[model samples]
Target: MRSLVLCLLTVVAFGSCLKLPSSFKKCDRKRTDFNQCLSDAIYGALKILDKPLPSHGLPSLYDIEFPDEVATIGNRTYGLLQTYYRPRCIGLSKPENINAKLEFGPLTSTLTIEATYSQLTVETGFEAQGTIVLLPVNVVTPFEYTLVNPTYTFTFELEEYEKGTTYFRVIDSKLDMQAHGLKLDYKQLFSNKILNDEFNSAMNVKWREIFALSKSIDEDVFAPLFGTIVNGFLKRVPVADLFDG
Candidate 1:
C-alpha cells in the first residue's frame, strides 16, 4: 500500500512537470507579437495624425457632429463619429470608414477607424479582413488656417489573407464636402475651425489612452489563442520602426 501511494505521487509530479507542446509555446510567442503589433499600429497611426501639419485653408465643411450616445465598457465611455469624403478623382471606391472617438466629458479621449475588405473564391473560400487605424486628430481652438489646401493620398496593400476577398467594405466613412455642395461660412470659419481642432485634439489624446488600455486587454484575452500567429508573422518579416521618434 505504501509503495503504491509513493508511485502515484511520483506520477502526478512527473505529469505536472511535462512541458507544453512546442506549437503552444510558439502560439504564446506569436500572441505577444500580435499584441505588440496592435499597439504599434495604433500608436503609429496616432503619431501620423499628431505630427504638426501646416493648417491650410479652413476645412471645406464644418461642425460635423458626432454621436452623443456614450458606450461604457469598464471605466470608459466611447463616442463615435461618421464622415465621408468623396475623392475628387476616383476610379472605384467603397464606403467610408467608421471613425470612433472616445471621451470622458469635455476632455477628448480616443480616435479609431475601421475598414474591411472581402474576397470570394469558389475553390479557396470567402476571406474577409479588417483594419482598424487609431489616430489623434486633436483640434486646437483659435486654429489659424491658410488659404492653400494641400492634397494628400495614402495607399497600402491589404494583408495577404484579406486581399482575397471579393467585396470591400469601408466603415465610418468621411465625405469631402465640395462634392456634396457643402460650403463653410467664412465669418464662422475661425470659430468652427477652432471647435473642430479642439475636438480632434481631445480625440487624439483619448485615442492614445484607449489604445494602451486595449493592448493590455488584448494581451490578456487573446494571448493564449493567437500569440503564436503574431510571433510567427513578425519573425518572418523585418520589423519596421514605424512610430520611432
Candidate 2:
C-alpha cells in the first residue's frame, strides 16, 4: 500500500516544476536517459517528501491517515468482514531499486513504475468478524502488520485536463503488489487462547493465499484513493510546465 502512495509521490515530486524544490533534479523529456534521470530524481525526492510542502502542494508522508473502512473478502464459507478506523501507517523504507518508463502519446501519456521497498509497517484500530474455513471469528484489536521486501508495479494513464491550466489527471491505473515476508499480530481472538494461537498460526501459514484472495478488494479500495491524492498536486500545475521542451 505504501508503494501505491509513493508511486503517486514519484509523480508529485516532479509535477511541482512550477517552483521545483532544490532537492529535486529535473529531467529533460527529450533526453535519451530520461527514465534513468527520473529514477534518480525520485530517489532524491523521497528523502525530503516525508514533511509537508505546502508551497509544492504536497502533504507530509509521515502522518497520512485513513478514515473508517469496511471490506469483505472471500466466499461466505471462508471470508472475512473487517472494519478499520483511524488507520495510520509509518515506516516506509526508501526504495532499493526503482525504474520509471514514460510514453507520451498524441492525446494522452502513460507512466509505469516498478519499485521495491525493504520494509513497511501499518497500525490500525479495527474489528473483525468472519468465518475461516468454517470456524467463526469475532475479534476487536489494534492491528499491526509489517511487510518485508515488498515490490509493486503500477501504470498510470494520464491525460491533460483543464483546471485553469493544462494539468494532468489519471485516466486509468493498474497496480500489482507482492511481498517476500509479512508479520501480523493481534492481541486476542474469540476470547479463547487456543483459538487465538491456532488462528495466528493459520494466518501465517496461508498468508499468500489470503493476500491473493483479498488483492482485488484492496485494489478497489485503494486505487482511486491514490489517484485522488496524486491529482491533488498534479492538478495544480500544467504538464508542459513540468518538463523542459
Per TM-score, the best of the predicted structures is 2
Q: What is the C-alpha lDDT of each candidate?
A: 0.25, 0.69
Q: What digit string (tens of lDDT, one per residue) describes model 2 on residues 1-245?
A: 99777647756764433546657677889999988987777666655767777776666655566675455443434587776566565643266777888898989999887777887666777676777667777778877666678876767889977644467888887777778877776757557778777767778788787667756765566566556666676776676656765
Give the Å shift of residue 130 in candidate 2.
5.0
**Residue clash pairs of candidate 2:** none
TM of each candidate vs. truth: 0.16, 0.79
Give me the runs in candidate 2 sitting further than 4 Å from their true place.
1-18, 74-80, 130-136, 162-165, 190-198
User: What TM-score does model 2 achieve against the real structure?
Assistant: 0.79
